[model samples]
Target: MKSKMLTVLFMFFTMYSGFSQDFQGKATYESKTQVNMDFGNRQIPEDRKKEIMERMKKANEKTYELVFNAKESLYEEDEKLEQPGGNSGRGRGFRAMGSAGGDLYKNIEDGRYLIKNELFGKIFLIEDDLEKLDWKLESDTKQIGKYTAYKAVAVKTVKRPNMQALFRRRNTDGKDGEGTKEKKVEEFIEKEVEIVAWYTPEIPINQGPADYWGLPGLILAVSDDVTTIVCSKITLNPKEKIEIKAPKKGKKVTQAEYDEISREKMKEMRENFRGGRGGGRGGARF
Candidate 1:
């Protein structure tokens, strides 16, 4: 009887492992952000403004993919490389300005996450425990592709760039204003954004793009007024298994530390842009 029980337990364990592996898959998402073209003090010709608008449109529309299994997921932006001698559709009047999309990995079962961020040409690897979101699930349901998705809402405090404060006011306290000083000011405004997410329990995985997770299902669509991300395609149980790994390259830092570093860098960039300016006030102390 003991030998028989052992054999039965071994078979059950194998079946469960196979089931988990079979449910692994990949999802592709299309993201778009609605942004106002606010060029402060930077004047451009009307025709040039049109070109910049077109470029901004392409830049705001992005493609991302999430590869996941039963426990963990890796998310990153998918970029289309411009081949040599290929027309990029980008105008030559202005340089195409863009930052590297950060990579995020989350372990659902263990409540762990790793974020690899590149800000102002500096790399930072943020590794910390997952932040539990207080999501309010609703009874509303809709069809996303073939899956039935349910609605959920979360309030998140996010740091947004203040375009008006891009240029700092200079100090005029100088001997006949012969020399000037540049004042570093805070450029980020902290505010709450309502996040709406649609998830499907049929997938049986608690995963989503970016830093969103902990739903009873896999998130299919997420929007927060300004930005929206929707799943475009999904491939389940492909022939080759997806490899999920944490990002290891970059200066090691916590999430809070990284935020401080980012703010400091932005201040430096603002000061550098204005050349030589006078002292100003009204920036955050920390």
Candidate 2:
């Protein structure tokens, strides 16, 4: 009886991995993100937490129109997660537009996004150089709809990707392999991410948000800083053959450029909003 059961289990897992690519589902994530500046591991003051909070709070809600299928269906959506209130008069994230779309796998791989508003739209992309999947197979599992999946931890790095190699010896579109010319940034470019997914061999596709894909099932939960965007609520096949793709608007830059540009924009906005002045009797502190 024991031998028979083992064979059945092996057959089931093989089936599950094969079917992972074709699944489409929805999920929600509960995240606590804290941002810190790094100039060689220097510690920032605790009091400054409010300032960071204020910057995020001030950021305007952003949305995007994700178009899947060679220009299939499109929807307008605010892309970034936000706090419920507006920014102070100084204005931070003055033009934040957070949204996205595409097929389960193809969308994210296209690697493009619109930041701020349509007028000030910018691009956001990620270049992952991870070998194999980061998640591990676990004996502990859970049921997401009909699929059962295990958890895994992906420990890897996110760097300012060198676009020179992409150009393949073409000078017109090639960048120097050295990365950004600016002083080397001290941010923790690489991150250790943990993902919990429930996929079955019923599907066959390798697609997940950047840096994560290739598992037995659809990735229901993923966290890797910018990629942490998770499924807050899931309604599987809310509509059939839901497609995922990249946003088309604004400028296009490599993953490395996007990383620095985003944080710098945030930094500049926060800096301008700093030590809020021109206040009443009780003024805002820096």
TM-score winner = 1
Q: Which candidate should be chosen as best, given lDDT against the real structure?
A: 1
What's model 1's lDDT at 263?
Answer: 64
Residue 30, candidate 1: alpha-carbon lDDT: 93
lDDT of 2 at 133: 52
Give lDDT for model 2. Answer: 0.38
Per-candidate Cα lDDT values, in order, are 0.69, 0.38
Task: State each model's C-alpha RMSD to the native.
Answer: 9.6, 12.1
TM-score quality measure for candidate 2 = 0.47
Candidate 2 residue-wise lDDT at 253: 46
What TM-score quantifies how close candidate 1 is to the native fold? 0.77
Model 1 C-alpha lDDT per residue in residues 1-286, reported as the tens digit of each score: 4564344335435544556554688999998877666555444588997887786677778888999988889888885786687443322111111112578888888888887776644666887888788988776778999987878899987776654455443444521122534333457777788999998776767788777887777899998857889998988898997788878998988877866666665565455444443223432222
lDDT of 2 by residue, 78-172 (tens): 34544368422212222211222211123333442322122113333332232465555555556655554445455554442121111112112
Lowest-scoring 10 consecutive residues by lDDT in candidate 1? 91-100
Which pairs clash in model 1? 171-278, 171-279, 181-277, 181-278
Give the backbone clash total of model 1: 4
